[model samples]
Target: MQLGLSNKDQKKVLTAFYSLGEVCGTIWDNIV
Candidate 1:
């Protein structure tokens, strides 16, 4: 199940994921 991403790519992916999560949370908070 490994996508074989290099360390740099993995970091970028994680950063993007966290950024997306933060954006979603902001929207949710505004809605609530």
Candidate 2:
């Protein structure tokens, strides 16, 4: 299934997810 986002948009989404994952990781590390 595709969301029909353009290449640039896809890149933005990927970057957003990457940063979000990093943020979550930092929070998890702090909690533990």
Candidate 3:
């Protein structure tokens, strides 16, 4: 549902709603 979209969209939703370790590093990079 999310990974298909742009990295921005994926980060926006995941950072706010989810906390799966699989994506933590990716999201952290997105934020910083």
Write model 3 residue lDDT over 1-32, tens digit each, in one string: 53678889877877776556657878888999
Best by lDDT: 2
| TM-score against native, each model | 0.89, 0.91, 0.35
Clashing pairs in 1: none
Candidate 1, superposed: residue stretches over 4 Å from native:
none
User: Order of all candidates by lDDT, from best down to worst?
Assistant: 2, 1, 3
* Candidate with best TM-score: 2
lDDT for position 25 in model 1: 100
lDDT of 2: 0.95
Ranking by TM-score: 2, 1, 3
Each prediction's Cα lDDT score? 0.94, 0.95, 0.75
Deviation of model 1 at 15, angstroms: 0.1
Worst 10 residues of 3 by lDDT: 14-23
Given candidate 2, what's the lDDT at residue 22?
A: 100
| Model 3, CA-based lDDT | 0.75
- Candidate 2 matches the true fold with a TM-score of 0.91
lDDT tens per residue, model 2, 1-32: 46999999999999999999999999999999
